[model samples]
Target: MGDLTMYRYDSYDQAIVDARVEEFRDQTQRRLAGQLTEDQFKPLRLMNGLYLQLHAYMLRVAIPYGTLSAAQMRVLGGIARKYDKGYGHFTTRQNLQYNWIKLSDAPDILAELAKVEMHAIQTSGNCIRNISSDQYAGVDAAEVADPRPWAELLRQWSTFHPEFTYLPRKFKIAVIAADEDRSAMRLHDIGLKLVSRDGVIGAEVYAGGGMGRTPMVAPLIRDFVTEDEIVAYLEACLRVYNRYGRRDNKYKARIKILVHEIGVEEYRRQVEEEFAHMRQQGLNPPVEELARIRAFFAPPAYETGLSDKIDRADPAFALWVDRNVAAHKAAGYAIVNISLKPQGGIPGDASAEQMELVADLADRYSLGEIRVTHAQNLVLPHVRKADLPAVWQALEEAGLAEANLDLITDIIACPGLDYCALANARAIPVAQKIAARFADPQRQRDLGELKLKISGCINACGHHHAGHIGILGVDRKGVENYQLLLGGSGAQDASLGQITGPGFSEDGVVEAIEKVTDIYLEQRQDGERFLDTYRRIGMKPFKEAIYG
Candidate 1:
């Protein structure tokens, strides 16, 4: 058993080995028996990232590599229906959480998850969470190649990694295959961008970036690390973070804080030293093992010679292409974004019926594959060029086709006060108002691509920090007031939005966004995006236009 080179499970292989399940089950029983109180049980629960938030107990399940079969999705649905309130929330890091689970059912839930080849191992600990990649990794036109296999390799290596299980704070890792980052790599603890130089694949690494009370974009550490050295290099980065990251104050404990306090250059040097030591110890996975992992993610059988023909006459398809569809590596197919926002519908909220519909669409038109995007949207990754019309029809029927992926109407919003007790104000109503204001299809098309994100609180659930136009709802004197921020993005060139003047009332925020948009339309250069124009003109012009 010790000699086995690869650790990935096959169909017949036991998931928990019976002993591990019994161990966790025993721990649960002990906690219930009063051998441990909430304080002692908290750490053990956090080892799984299970937390009793303001309103409910949340169970975060790790989805390694963000890849799941239809059967697995059904299992997740079952769990959600059984333990939670018939719905689960998909997080930015490619994981799902049931927010209303009972403490007594947690162990049984874990055991249920194990039955479907899944677990929450290392999801909440100081150790690494699930390693995420571009949701459209294999399907995107701009990708050098799919980065899923490499992500899988890291997932296997990092799971139950002994040295990292006791790090000072949580760690996140993201990999991007496309030239432009679809994974929001810059906003993660560690970012890896695949690059090809002289016919050899390597990774460009970034370290110590995160979003929280203090948001910091990751800084570049190494321009390139060869594929063979990835594990060794990652070990070095983890060592640096674990050793130097603060433990005294929870607020000052993330790797981002350490990176900022010590400077990127110093952090890089420390990581290099750690990497060298790991290399000396020969802990790196061999090339053959990497190849074996890669085999599981082999490209699906794609039809030859797919065409990118645009039907200029079809306004609906044109609108879809202009907003929802992204460039694909294949000639005939497109990476389609299935908007969860249907006018006033909840962002990223997919009902059980909707999930089944999506699964059916995946089977019919998209080669049986679906991806949950970081932007609170879903992706039909491999939809054939000719099948787009049918796919759109099905999506429309299911209320999943909004045709407003990146426009002002396609607002990314958190659950807010309506559902989440942590929220200070209502996010859904604000988002609905903004969408209604810019509901005109022609006006939205003319306005072009704009990213608007909203969060009910500073925890940044909606990724407000990454939006081109960010809206943060705050409570003052028991009243809701929203703060506006300009010039933020979640792509390769990510920058936190700058706050604009004073906050607005719930009724005033939509007008504020409109005023900002009007200013952009006036000052924007030919064919410039909202972020581009905001960057070129700065916030002064927008502030003057909105508040003047």
Candidate 2:
């Protein structure tokens, strides 16, 4: 067993991140002192993951591949408490956003983050943003292999890559180990799935998938590309997109659009040609370098043959176990998902105390490691089944335990008009309203596995395009209007949701969602979920239920 924690920043890594921090520090002072104008400084701030939102500057910190150590998480909590409000929002991209950061204090924030070996570089730029992976990457019972090292490798390769720093639009990538794509693989600009071929495991590439004004599920671009060739292949794909991807229309600038316009076959042909060239140029790093990175992600010392039997003394504990705990590859260990969507609470909003508590919990229950899920939740990847009762008790006491993993109340929502300047409406309030509608624990259990996602704007940060029940906020004249969408999914069967008739007022949208759920409950066949029933009955029945 080696270190189970994520890869720490080496001196070279530290030098790179530290140099960036110092450079940005001077840039910040120059802007504050009016030595540089806002126009002159906008790109600089954005490159460091700083954005000027509605009321203040927002800092987006990258949690690479959604992995964090207890110390890192605690620092995040401290930053939230000291800098912004007492809470931070974990985003769909597995990053944390502090909405009230000041331009003057930004350098200090970055410096503190550097102490923990994390930075916000490429988090906001038109570059390959944070590479996300499955929260249960190493511990999943059916996991093929851990995807973090590969994601980290990509993070290194893509960070400050000169050719890609000025692409037409921002790029996102996700890597998943097994058949199950937990990171919403298909919705990214590029998705890499690890697959076994003739006893040789490699990546199955999916390109051109994105959700914005025009959402499309990415097509399979390559059946298999060996680990050695993956980096070169990705470079090839990005190069093709960089050369030909649309820059004239900002709306049509993503790689998905280029793939759509050029046809997947044509796009694949171009990528293969570029890949061949890149391979000859030695784009792939030597295998030894990757192996060194892999050592940091080696399996933790999992106590073997520790009893798999879960204690069933407490019914509440059992319920939590059933809902939040997932099976682990190690017999004695289990993967624990910590829900940020406590009933009627702001989705993915973790208060400083709660964050501190969770960090303490990870130290005690897990091996000082935590993961941020794409669905805006935290996960404790390694836990003894026997320790669950105590863990649940601690979580319950700290208000961190919410036994509604895939229930109706587990909503994915954006910061919306409350914090985002781009948003036309308030998504948090709407999600709160809907979560309150079905706050009863029993009611939630009855409406099993309903994924409701809300986006405040067309950017789809909340991933409304992939929800079983999607709500997109758009401006109608001057007021907030929301359109409901049905049948979208973010899993391996990734599909975009369809808009259901006209838009609704904030209250009306909540009512419409309630009506949709009511219809699902009434019409669903035995053992059918919300999406399953919707698939069976199509959209007409659902449309009638709401429209009528």
Candidate 3:
């Protein structure tokens, strides 16, 4: 049980799970034979996180550690073209969905995903879905090391783990190695940060956090847990959540609600007891296995002593470096963020042609590697300084070279009411209008890095609660009303945004944002970010600037 073999399969061995395809097909046929009703078939679908939303069924496919090959992306593209409406949506939790999928075709779709070493297992269920990490984990300069292999290890252990599959609500886990948590760890059911204390690597664990009807930020349960005890401690926390978490009401079912009700101290005590029990049973994964997992994530062969030449040559590239690139463990290389929100284009919607272009760029410049970020962008993790201009040129031809990374125009928005049945108002159109309003490159650069996030509904799928300026769209009467929230962040110092004032109509929302930005520009201290300025001056000036 302490070995990697204890887990079902690794990435290379996942193709073997395709044998379950025939089993699922048989199950589907049985259900259609009047043998299984909605109740009987519900558990099976729950295993896959396939839920029947208001109008149609949605299929969520787990993307282990948020890493995908070009071949896998092509398979997803094919699924979108054939099974869906020629489009697929990537979620904030590092999963992808096909909204228009028919229930009858789900089995076949799962079979197809299995061929590509993917599945929907526990994606929508009470069990753990995909384990996510920073999209630029290994490559980011801010990282101590890549957290992907650890995430991959957790993914294998949690996939269909028998003990905690019947939890009251869904669970999510996020790991981050960045100095400023790019993975949005605070908003997850369990958040892990890699840390070294006294020359020993371990994790700082946070638990009982999530968003929905009742949003909550996770509390730190342990300052550090040794590498060998990670899995056992996680299991202990889940057990505590499973046994005591409220299930009578769906609103109170999340671990967050339970933590709130009992208090974090009591919850911590309970988890400690469970951890002690598991430790006594020798259920902790072995140290050798941890090392084995680490071996898979060894750093790529990089040329030594490469110069930071790109920073000197192009002022535009320097701006990109200052805003988009994070500190990497390796010298002469950087993690480059490819912003999907280019000017008036849709946020996170990559056309098939665009996807192909990215694949080509990945092969040519980035060692055939590309990662889809949780913020609805792409990452070229291992780019050298010298090759950046060539990569930029290729991206420009593909219409993927909008250099507004971390600027005001690089907004994170969901598909919103136009597509999502859960949405009250359209999110994409609002994001488009905002981007259009600030389309001037000089204006955006002057404003600096301001993170604006919007969600179509209260589910917070678009991560509005964590934005520097968060917008949550609501329906008031027949029209759409947008609420403005200020001073929130998703990085290491995570905080939920506070409401600034009353909601605004769709036509007035962009003006309100402009008003806020104008206030920041006028009053901000030198080198102060939008968040830092708001933190120092409070929201009164902003409120007055916008309302008065």
TM-scores vs. true structure, each candidate:
0.92, 0.99, 0.92
- For residues 177-223, could you state the per-residue lDDT of candidate 2 as single tens digits? 98887899999999999878888768999999999898989999999
lDDT of each: 0.81, 0.91, 0.80
> Which candidate leads in lDDT?
2
Task: Give me the runs in candidate 2 sitting further than 4 Å from their true place.
Answer: none
Distance (Å) between predicted and true CA of 363, model 2?
0.9
lDDT of 3 by residue, 112-210 (tens): 888767788767777786898888767766666668767877876786688877789888999887578878898899999988889877899998777
The parts of candidate 1 lying over 4 Å away from their true place are: 1-8, 11-14, 17-23, 29-35, 305-314, 419-422
lDDT of 2 at 63: 94
Tell me the spans in candidate 3 whose CA falls farther than 4 Å from its real position. 1-16, 27-43, 49-56, 305-307, 311-323
**Predictions: Cα RMSD each:** 3.6, 1.2, 3.5
Model 1 lDDT at residue 316: 76
lDDT of 1 by residue, 369-444 (tens): 6777777677877778788888887887888878887788878888788767678888889988888888898888
Full-model lDDT, candidate 1: 0.81
Highest TM-score model number: 2
Candidate scoring better on lDDT of 2 and 3: 2
lDDT score for candidate 2 against the true structure: 0.91
